[model samples]
Target: MAKVNGKYETIFIVNPNLGEEAIAAIVEKFKTLIEKNGTVESVDDWGKRRMAYEINDLREGYYTLIQFESAPTFPAELDRIYKITDGVMRSIIISRD
Candidate 1:
């Protein structure tokens, strides 16, 4: 039988250069998006931190982690949004189930 839902954990790095308000907006955007599509288990904002390697000349980024349970197909749509969003430096979504 097909799984109706799956637990997922996603971590995304936002470009810190956008400043606090922009950063918060980005975080809120994703939080709402997730909440609309799933049951959010937790949202962890790790705040600004230096990266291990430079990405597009950036050395630091604001990080956020989200844990949720949703239909198995939702992560793909979430990932696509992350890739297209301007301030998102990087993102990864993993199935916890």
Candidate 2:
């Protein structure tokens, strides 16, 4: 039988150069988006941290991690949004189930 829902964890790096307000807005945007489509288990804000390597010539990024349970199709849609959103330097979503 097919699974109706699955557990997922996603982490994304935001460009810290955007400043505090913009960064907060971006984080809030994704939280609301996930809540609309799924049940959020937890959210962890790692704050600004140095990356293992430079990206776009920047060395630090704001890190956020979210764990949730949602329909199997939701992660792909979420990934699409991340790819298009500004200030999202990197992102990855993994199935936990």
Tell me the spans in candidate 1 whose CA falls farther than 4 Å from its real position. Answer: 1-3
Model 1, 1-97: lDDT tens digits are 8769899999999999999999999999999999999999999999999999999999999999999999988999999999999999999999998
Error of 2 at 9 (Å): 0.4
Per-residue error for 25 in candidate 2, Å, reads 0.4
Model 1 TM-score relative to the real fold: 0.96
The true-structure Cα RMSD of candidate 1 reads: 1.3
> What is the per-residue lDDT of model 2 for residues 1-97, given as tens digits with 9 covering 90 to 100?
8768899999999999999999999999999999999999999999999999999999999999999999999999999999999999999999998
Collision count of model 1: 0
Cα-based TM-score, every candidate: 0.96, 0.96
Candidate 2 ranges beyond 4 A from true positions = 1-3
